[model samples]
Target chain A: MSQPVRASLWAGLYCPGLPLSAVWDHQPGIGPVAVHSHQRGQARIFQAGRIAAQHGVRAGMGLSQALALLPQLQSRPRNPAMEQRALEQIALAAYGHSHQVVLAPPDTVLLEIAGSQRLRGGLQPLLDQLVKTLRQQGFRVRCGTAVVPAAARLLARVGQHADSPERLQHTLDALPIDALGLAPGKQQAIIGCGLRRLGELVRMGAPERARRFGSALNAELDQLYGRQPTPLAGWQPPERYRQRLELPVPSERSEALLFAGNRALDHLGGWLEVRDRALTALHVTLEREDAGNPIALGLSLARPGFDRARLLEMLALKLDRIRLPAPVAALVLKAETTLEHRPPQADLWDGRNHGDAWPALLDRLRARLGEEALSGIAPQADHRPEHAWRWVPPGTTRVCTETRPRPTWLLPEPRPCQRADFRLEDGPERIEAGWWDGQDCRRDYWIARDGRNRRVWIFHEHEPRSGWFLHGLFC
Target chain B: MPEAQPLQHLLDQRSDLWRGRRRPQARCTGSGRAELDAWLPDGGWPCGRLVEILPACLGSGELDLLMPLLAEQTRQGQPVMLIAPPLVPCPQRLHRAGIALDRLVVVRAPDQALWAAEQSLKSGVCGSVLVWHPRGRVDARSIRRLQLAARESDAPAFVCYRRHQQPPPSLSALRLGLEPGPQLTLLRGDGPTRALHLGRANVIELAVRRRQSASAP
Candidate 1:
């Protein structure tokens, strides 16, 4: 019996003009935009949209020449932060379609979808859905599928479609040697030899091709043909989310810092969802120009949080309290701490615990008022009423021993009092401890009712101090 | 699926499923004072609901009435928060009453007390929230909102209103009017209006009498 060999399938998604596309998505209908970058002290086009390209603008064209050709061409500086965020978003979208996703930078995403074809009903429908979703997310994508990952990426990059290994190989052979991304010197040498296509280069003697073009061309071809395994390090969601962004202009207003911080949080929320983690603490740093240290605003959540609205609300509160020493030129947002998020178990009848809302509110209050504003009461091991207790940070664990009923309120110091119009309801509970600390106290405690019938806890000092004093109140 | 039905039934029966909140259990938490617990519904203070406490005056043992609930909750690792308490809390006294001082949070902003209480109740981080609305007239709508918020979480909420101030139209799950001599009168609840004597033995009185008798010789 003879067995037929089955071909593995991979999908490649490429965005031709990602930098310009990201800017266009943010500032839509800004009349034919071109993303420009400084090269050798000259402004050069990094990416140009279809509209800009139609007006005779292209990548590598000098900005001055392009502007002269099309007066309506709106050139914007390339924002790497925005481009990176957009790429991460594309990778996240691909993750939903397949388990193994490889991020090819500047920008493309390759997904292993061979096994997922049957589950998704077939490759066409999956690709169709992916293209539709990516377009809806403000991206222009050219998708291609082939038998090998490298061939898929090459086909996608070149806007070619190949479904079978034989067809992919044929297309690869006919592809220009420049498609291999070889060094410019090697590519020029290969092209200068009158070998324009890969098929012509392959027909040459192997040693001759290596000695002239070097082994890079052969290595890329071998990987593309599956003669050598193309092991792509699959894109993994980052362990933490840290985004640094430069402001368009320096501003001393703290509110301006918050505006930039919010943009970072939007990306962070997406990243947290991708990584399946909840943020517990965040550090927002304002990079100041000529400053002592970066103004760091920290938010600590009582419970793990992911909601962006809540995060922004807390940030707004925190930002209001920061007094900027100098103008901030840039801002950085870091998820300083995170926890594996486990969604609260839904109750069969009561549904989910809405009690989690308080942590966010508490965090907001703490962010505005400072950590010292909130404290928990904890008991110390002293016998003196004032010395026996202390104020501790909330959430601390302390042991409390059971004793008799005690007053709810205690005075800082016992105030001298007259017994006039106050009826003594209970009397003479003697306490003789606390002699070891030199401030020995001997007192007889009593419960009294004031003229207004308010209950007060009073005590009389023994010996040297015979006067009655008010100690505490029971409410 | 057929085999799972019986398993599901057993799970439902034996499981401590927190499907929303069930009715107060028959073995509810005791009020620490035996005399007080006997008069209370479910043999103790109810859980997962708002209780309106109307004190005749400040320092009328209103805190003592809830001390047992506070102590029990803190012992179980559930925190207790007091929002805008009328008087400064003595941590030593609370610790002596078996309440963990570390588990007790006192929020002192009077204007934001109700908001803090509602947030704390909904936060589920605390076992109970004691909100003292001393000055402002809290409307029925606010009370209703608080009651609804309390029902969504496991923590019990207590709103303290001064006595003689007309009760808000919004009804809480339970209402008790505290009088002098540490007495509690049920203002409203599922049960009938009645008085409860929370009179415990005054250790001061007992000791004084004992000393006097011993000196008579």
Candidate 2:
């Protein structure tokens, strides 16, 4: 006896009401809604909500007829762009389940899960988790599994499942010829020939069927039953994430904007998660209602990571500082830059890790206090006291070889003073340099004590511009 | 002993209870000055605790007092943060004092000094944090927040108040008043309010005189 090899499995995710749901999901507590599009130059209902359907609104019905059937029916034009974006988002979500994802537009995502099934425990769990994730993202999803992509999509459209080859054969045999999704004229021709079930069509002689229905039907049947290969272009996740969410209502409150932005950020997090990348900078644009210029807020992180909570916190901080010029109608979040996420290596002995919090603290401080408010000081090899140091990013380390008895504090600018105001403690550490940068300074520096017994660095300029100036503190 | 069990339990639960004879050993980092360490209750600066330093005047050896602790921390590759110092910190001086200038983070949050200090302490990554609060504006509530944050993290936090500002009762673990002579008065801590000379001021003066004589000769 010969052993049978395991066939590859594909799962199809079908979203039946994508056109209507994609527009209605963000806006809550609205009346019955229906999506209408131009079909053969006549506006027809593409999809209708449950409430709208209850009032005799159906897909392919004229929009004027739907409104006439129920005067209170809310109708929106079908947005193909929005639907395409919605499909891509679902595909991005499915990419987390399996690396091989094929997107069938207008609303189907197919995933080859044979390789990843063991990692996800089993086929059923993977399908359940995928459906759960999509549902949580406010999409109505039905899943079906089969040995081939076309069969999986067909079963998903009919809300059926066929996991194994034997089951797939049984399911496809019982499915009617209508489920083949042939051209309308071809479907009618096949039905007219007394072909009621797919099992009968499969049992017919292949040459005769090909002669009667041309080679396309036989090829599709061969691909469906795994006899011929179904080559699909795999969908690759985009490098950048840009999601816009339409607000339910125009509101000027920052909390409202944040609430809408949180959804877009979730999608960004999911997109980044699949790519193993961290977002370093994000740009958010607020679409204003008054036709004014949109407000753009950019947040750059000190440490890059797809930490949703941290990003939200930073957004909240930015929102708290800005007064919205007008009520926002939509919120758009774009990932400006991303870095490959690398987890910090833990030390073998140290059980407690304190290194991770440093970057988070820096990010938080910069978010609230502005970027210029924090810096690390690096010593520069310059003779001028004021020019001897420069501001650097925090946590940067450099070696300084020059060791001199400089004051603990250098004043931003020297304050002119009378020489008699201070008692000289130490005299004449002359610094004459900076001629190259056109900031030449020739001053005699002294350590002096003021009336309050505080040590200060004072300087006396040479020649044409001479004055006693307090320069620094010895604290 | 059986009848006093409830009272003893209450005393143990209450952190404010002061036991005169029995002193609990606390986790500490040495101040690097023998005289000051001997005077401190914990034999050093208490770790994970807020220490409020009230200087008598600007440039009155406040930074000098913290120089040793900062140097020790930076040498160990731990970061030391200076939040809103009164003037620019000279990098050459810090390097000469054995402090790692690279590990020094200077935050200029003049209005949010206390908040930044609290966050730095709570982060636990910094070895030490020094925040210069505005004159007479350090409230008790903010101090309490800083104290709690410090207690939760290993970093020791120091809040420097302005000169001549009277020290209010705060939740600080240790409070010391500093003078130009580099003298320290233990304003609040485990021991009596005794004064101790820091011992470094005289050494600096002697070194200055020695350098002058060497140059004169």
Candidate 3:
């Protein structure tokens, strides 16, 4: 028989008591804590911390016994939602190193590192770095590597570190038959035959073991030894990116929050690249402790773009105007809109893309100065000088077809003027309308020259008490 | 003759330090007025510098004087930013005057107007900046800051104030008082000590050309 050469590498990361760890990380250094879960009509400690462990409170211990060991122990109910989210976060972090990451629910991850082992400098260094990073993220990680996925997971579960398929066989041989995850009756039946370790069980003929334990035991052994394929479903990143980051220090200034937001934005950039999309709108929710509601700032770009510098500039502009009600504890950034982007074609001869940057500049200005401040003029279909045009938001360009000359500046309200002080340069162009709206208008407008010869637009009332009123200025 | 010789000797002694003459820093942006351009150090409106225009009133045809230059800029797809305009600029008139409505940006808010103007000039995004009736008294320092900001982008900047509500003597390189004939009376700049009647027809011809080309397109 020829021995198969091990080539591909796989890593298994096992996280013990993740639910309790994820919660404890939020309030570290407070007190000894235990996570309790109800089982069989009695509450028991499902997970325990180092402090609780020192006091002899461990998993499966009755709640009463755990409390008896340490009277001041703080116990929190298990939160499965937070544990699930923490598992997803570990997967996301692993994505930075390799795309072939598979998540095993309730605390295990399988990473295919055959392609990335050399890129990461070697198997041992990569495993060490992965363990350190997981520990820093508040997870107790036990890692193992082997040629087969199941062997690596079993080795990590049994706290046996193996580096190669040749070494994995010895590590698996020592693990008891219970590591096969068979029914208890079947396990005891195998033990009744005096086969204690998995090596003894495998040495006993496979046909005899299969006939006694049903073919499942033989299949499990084949899978663990790399003889049979193990099915692993690869993880795919979620479509939308919504990341919340707790600031290291509580800040009362919005500008300070920007420093902490860069990490989240970097993650978002990676997420967008993976999805092959560009961001169009972003909504950032600033979480404050004292304030009842989180302050949300929404930025919409005129065109689909993924420029982080532009986003930071807009954020600075918004922060300049905002006075935080209280210190911000966290920031929740949600990408509200994204679009499929294609790279723009560069102009050849002049090397100038006309008006390509104007929209972005206008967007930045609107972000800083506000939408109302930047406006355009829309000519109204009216004859009164003041009603000739109205202020509209920027980018609204509806031109009136009238050829008559009009003033550029119009007063908010017309002022009564003494007609004798000015000379009428252009004769009256009559306008009488707006009767049904209750504000009746009957006026004869003219271009008048002031004492300083400045062009003034005025109108004389024809019906409702004859009077001259100044309204606009022609430039 | 002896006093003149002494003055000449003093001027020659400090030639390296003083240069003994005015070295023009203003780049031409074409004031749109022929006589005014001839009087200017450059043959036109100086670029990368602040030009203060004290209008006789709010509607003293100040915008008309700038229309040709703005139209030319907009024709090239360059933005023309109007900071804190006193009123809504009539779109029809601006369109007829050959200015691109898409390229025009009029900002309001009297308090933020100066800051907006400074940002617009410093950004190098706009081809020209016009701040109309900027509220509050501007000292020479603020004007100098605007000048420096304008110099960074080398875009022409104009700050218009009502003659009645004149600010303290500005440090603008070119300061003109807009008079009755829609004319320019140079109160500052390196020209004659007296007022000069700027030929309005030069810009008027430019505006006519813009209208013709714009209509053809």
Candidate 4:
């Protein structure tokens, strides 16, 4: 029996102006901007914004030439590090759509979406959502889909789409020879050989093409046409999210700091969603103007989940309570610990149960009043009433062994009492234990009533100490 | 006649006005004690409302009065929070009272006790919230905030003030003064003040007596 094969679909995301957008996206409406690079001491424009391009500024133009065209042009040195980080962030967003995400650096992310197309309804909606997500992140993205990864990247670079092999062939044939991304000399050589369009060159026989042009060009053609498979390294997200954002102007107001903090938190939330993880602990550092030891605030959640609103609210609460020593110049958010996200199962009846909101409430309280303030109580097996209970983390439950009558409230330390102050009611329930742990206790406990008619737990020491002490209260 | 139309509309909107008819019943949870529930206007503890308990002294069976409700709430897998209790709550006693030890959250936030209580009450996740306020520390504004939060969530909140402190004027749905005889004086509620006996059984004595009886058999 013969089986049919499933064709794979690859979507390439191309960020045409990443070099300019990465630095200027946060500061829009600042007029035309261009990112330039120093090539052998001569600065050349690498990319230009739409307004700059409309003003006749093109890539490879000298900075002086672009300046002469538009005196109000804002030009910044190209930041390769920032561009790479932006590309990785785009890849993180793409990872949400497909698991097989390949990073094509200098600016493209290729996604294998054939396996997940059905799960996302269809290819068109998936591509639309992918573009919308990138756009919302303030990146200018163009998407192209094809059966071959190389063809998809090329199509995306030229702003075209080819969904099938035939469409890809049609699209590739109509392109000029420069679309091959060859060196200037090679492209001129191909054009001089009477091949102005790629269709003419592709129509030639493989051996003649290889003989005329070289094996590299022939191999490139084979990979683009899907005759040979293209193996690319897949991109893996980092385990932690640590990003610093500098404020445009240092300010003493906490609202400004919270605004910047929230932006970083949005990225962190997206990172967690794509990784299928929940953050349990976050450490944020406020960089001040005086360069003194930065103010560090750590937030720990009772339950791990990517709840952005709750996290932001807790951060706002912390910011409101803190008195900044100096104006903050930058904010750094770092989250290292995460757990695999296990979403709670919904109740069948749609009841108003805040089971999910419980942890968030605990988180908010702890964020304001520190972690030591919250605890749960559990019974210990010791016979001594004072040693019969211990504090545990909230929401922890354990099986408590049966015991004799104990007070509802146990004092931290037994207070000395006069024997005449209380009227005895219940007889003594002897408890003599804890001798093994160096703190030996021999006491006879009784339930009595104080003058106010309040039930009190009193004990009389028999060994090592002799006194009447009020130990607990019935209420 | 035109001026009287607006006046008539205002009168129609007033829910507390005496219409000389039976009003709609308020939602409540049974107080576990049948006699106490009978004396309450709602036939039980009011839900989603603040119930202020004023004790003559610490450990005047104030906590015992609510033990039954807390135990029932915990049994249903709902969380019960105790904010800044005057002393450590004995888990053995709570356990014997049929309360789930795991579902109990004890927060020692003495400074922000009312704040924590308000947050817990507003979160709607807790089954009940109990806050112990120092004498004369609570103000009318904070109590009003607590009352509003309690009204918004399903959790019942209990604010226990220290002994003999003058109760502040506030919007609490119910207020009771606890005395030495374990008696409850209805300071504020749907009805006027009345001394109601709270014949609460000491669970500790019951446990010890039951153990002895089982051993004898």
Candidate 5:
């Protein structure tokens, strides 16, 4: 394959882990503003004060302080997961538009368009299309392309990045060292030494630079130039199985709805048998025809398994709380986030299960028992007497988050099962936990049998209090 | 090029696949019951295609009309899917209709019932998929995929919609329109006996009219 020649383009790029903001009618009159994590200090040329920008209420500024800066500014907690997901989605979408997608660490994407130059008609027309797509999605996109991804990123930081100017070297050289997103202390050190420009840093010898600054500093520079090639190996989408239902009229009644749902589960079950794609989570969307937005419900799996009845049973446990305010017009179900698991090879057996003749038995139980009223127990991240295991929602077949050895019987809400009077039909198991969090507990737990020979795990807290609690039963 | 046969000859040959005629596929056979079998031209529905069942609203005896067929298919040992339907078909009532309760699997994909139907078809496992997407638009592409899936698995896909009227270029091999028709006045004056009327069981070579005259007017 021919190597793609680099050229200028309107690139909508962002660093997932970076904190960026666009103030109302944000103009490029001021200098660089570093969104730092520190408090009690301000950098020179700070364009927008922490108190001014929507979420920038100074690094250590409290929520009230930030709100006071801009009362109407919408606020949302900073979630690295949310940012990463959004970046991956946008990157995937942009990938379809451009074949060569450059993914940066944590969360940054680069689309190289040098090869598409001739077929792109003209630079302005291409820029217009790119701008339109990115702007429509409410993103404050910085469009620029350099021969290198780092150069593009730096140029993006400076307002000089644009589609029309073919002279990219000048634009890149004009951006300050701070635009490179170097660590703040390093940036200050470099600026103090009068090394303000990317050009100034590039002029230094490799050995001297490596000796003065660390390998990270020089690697970043090498990455900015065309000397190193960085490529992103895109992720393959998970295989999904889906079913749909359309209603003649809108409806909210639960019973009037299963006529179609039952059929979908039957289809899914049969499909699962042939391929054996172990399914765990299902995303069900209920679309109200008149309304464009659909309410999306995401179900997670506790175990890697596939059994339509168990899935429906788990779903039934949660469906009672679902309120369809308006009549539903359509139903879409997609089982996703799948894993690979195959049962031992068996004879070519043809099996069929119909509307589970008594599907209502489970449905009725689910309807009566509020979702959380039923659950299964899973091991948790503790070895303490009380924290060794936890009760999670039923049908959660996922591996337990913890791997602590658990005593069979745990009392529910530790009742005072008197040990002297506490039938010592069974022995005690000593336990301890909590090296961190400070609320540590040590206890002597006993699997004692009642006069009726019923087994119970009873524990007496050794410190802080003298109380006996019934933990659980052996069965 | 294949020779085109007249409607009678074509349907006569189709009797084997359509179930209405004596020469019907064993799998296509539905409702050994004589009265109901006679009422249904193709016995019930073809084993491997689409059956479009349109109802005006929910709880309108929609399930009652299809239960007989579902029961027959279950007896034949073919799997069935009730796509995300408005309500679960009554199993007890299905038992009353002579369907084997043990031979059924019910999936509940609340709103994406259409997607669920397509997914079931994609698996090529079930003999039938019963869906209810009342106002959903079943475009030509989705219908074609469903048809292809059913053919691959030798299973059938049935969609029950709350549609006011059927769209052009029907995706179904058999389309039935059930309306709250004239009631049978009996001592059991419970409700109107909704009847299936104005349906297209099969698409024959209905003559195509030239939109514009071939010659000048």
Candidate 6:
């Protein structure tokens, strides 16, 4: 079957792109700001003073000279990695809307809308929504729709200054060939031969041009004019291991980050639950500061299929331990290097279930009493109350040791002199462990009801004084 | 679809999530507390609802009624989670009744002032949820969100009513008051006695003693 043709739509989601950069420079409200690099990290002004043909001072003029023309100008060091990451985040957000979203090199993204029309009632509505939603996210984007990728990009870029196709076409015509991102050699070659405009370049025959300049020039021209097929790789499908989230804002608070991180961990953890694959390497990519300065950091899991909660906890721990020099612009989580699937699991049958859902019961106890307070008495090879009772983390399979059968209750401590507040329905069930340890203990445990009509199992531990202790309360 | 039973009838019966239907031979353990279990046809309180518990806000053993059942179920694979259980809990005591503790995850929420535990229930990770909410006036919307979250997960949830302000209108299947038990009879020494009084749907059971005093030989 022939694949359906996709008429693409592009909304420059980076609305107010320049304004954002300008505002970010002043964010810390630090000394008069500029966004240019310096050997001493000193800020400089852009387009200092030399006038350009378009009536504005050209960038890179001498700072001393530029000060005479635009005295208020400020500049700071450029950040590109931050820029790319932010764009990628925006791209990912865009991808959530349509499957065929692709990231373009140098802050560009493509969204194929051939099939997403019905999702918004029609193509125009979809584009409108795509624009509106992004705008609500604080982006000031100029959007343009066209069947051609180059045309769409050119339109969104230039649509700000003009509206008509002919006017927009002139804007594209005025752009130097360098805007194409090709080498300067090609730009010089094009201009050197008197070829000044894209329209003029398109007028030439491909075969004639190829005969002189080779097919690379002809191909680029065809690609630019949409003469030959101009196919875009819609958004790249993320690897099987990725964490996603939808929050009101990209927050920077520590607790908020953990909350968001917990969600991401939950997502990643759920996937881990179904498979044996363990996340060995993880990368948290953030695109918030500015895409040009995207932040990428990583953590290596100690073992495969690591506990997700533990992993998230580690991230929060790591985040807490490290100082964030700058405010976070955005966050992304990437888990890599999955290894052999060893699913750490509980036993098929624990000695404690007693034909009931006892494991679940204990969980409630822990949740209620507190994790520190919740414990199980694993019967050891001993009859002594202390030996019969061993504190074990609940996940361990209950082991039944063939010694004196452990009594259900022990005196919290064997206290002397009391035929106290416990009733015995039957004779005491005796137990004695720890003979080898020399701290021998003998106890008579009984299942008794208190005066209030509640059941409790208690025991008397024999000592030099022969005492009674309230060990455990039966639920 | 045939309406096999009314909603109340359905509540009177329990079925394994996997079977999709209840069988006559399915062995269901009634609460085993006699008259109280008889009041609940399913042999206990409603399975998929919240039981608001209110104590002295400082007293102990408020959970004496529900603790054992929780211990018994946790010994098996299905784990129960208490979202904001008030106490750190004494697991050694639970183990005495054959309850397993390793599977229990007690999340401390006392420190978190905002206390947004709603998301935990929505995630559907636990077999049962116990939320200890501090005293605050709440509206119907928050209550609905919590109820919807628990119902959606099919996880039985209990929101313990901690204070004595007017009970907020709720979709909770059961509402319980756990005050002091009845006066203790003077035995070995004179001391105050307390009992657990339980009420559900206007039906009341008062001062059920959790433990009897020692008998004089």
Predicted structure with the largest lDDT when compared to the true one: 4
Question: Residue B135 of model 2: what lDDT?
Answer: 59
Tens digit of per-residue lDDT, candidate 2, span A1-475: 8787767888899999899877765455677888888978999998889888887799999999999998988877877888888898899999998989999887899998988888768878888888898887878798888989988888888888787878989999999998887899998988888999999999989999999888889999988887888879999998777888777668998888777777788788788888878778998989999978999888887777766788889889888878887799888888866566766555578765555677788888888888888999888878787877889888777778675578888888888899999999888888888778888879999989888877889999883368999998887
Model 2 regions lying over 4 Å from their true place: A1-5, A25-33, A39-44, A50-57, A60-76, A164-167, A181-196, A199-222, A244-251, A287-294, A336-340, A344-351, B1-20, B164-167, B190-192, B199-217
Best by DockQ: 4
Question: How would you order the candidates by lDDT, starting with the best?
Answer: 4, 2, 3, 1, 5, 6
**lDDT by residue for model 2 over B1-217, one digit each (tens)?**
8979998777767666788877656789888666678898888999999998988877778888888788778978888989999888887778777777767889997888988988888878899999998755557788888889999888778988897666568767799888876788988886857798765563364346445755995
Candidate numbers sorted by TM-score from highest down: 2, 4, 3, 1, 6, 5
Better of 3 and 4 by TM-score: 4
Query: Which stretches of candidate 6 lie above 4 Å from their native place?
Result: A1-34, A38-76, A136-139, A160-196, A204-217, A227-237, A240-427, A432-470, A473-475, B1-217
Determine which window of 10 residues in candidate 4 chain A has minimal summed lDDT.
A344-353
lDDT by residue (tens digit), candidate 6, B8-49: 467556543334354333223444245445443344544444
Worst 10 residues of 3 chain A by lDDT: A21-30
DockQ of 5: 0.02
Q: What does DockQ give for each predicted structure?
A: 0.34, 0.65, 0.47, 0.69, 0.02, 0.10
* Candidate 4 global TM-score: 0.82
> What value does the lDDT take at residue A205 in candidate 6?
81
Q: Where in model 5 is the C-alpha error above 4 Å?
A: A1-12, A15-86, A95-102, A105-107, A112-140, A159-167, A183-222, A228-475, B1-217
lDDT over C-alpha atoms for residue A364 of model 5? 30
Cα lDDT tens digits for candidate 4, A1-475: 7676788889999998788876664544668888899999999988888899999999999999999999988888887777888898889888888889998988899999998898679988998898888787778799888899999898888888787899999999999999878999988889999998888899999999888788799999989988899988988888778887766457779777777777777678789887778888899999998898899998888777767788888888888778998999888888966666667554579654455778888899988887788999998888877777898988787888856778888999999999899999997888788789988888988889888778899989987689899999887
Q: Candidate 6: lDDT of B155?
A: 55
Clashes of each: 6, 0, 3, 0, 74, 86
Q: Pick the TM-score winner.
A: 2
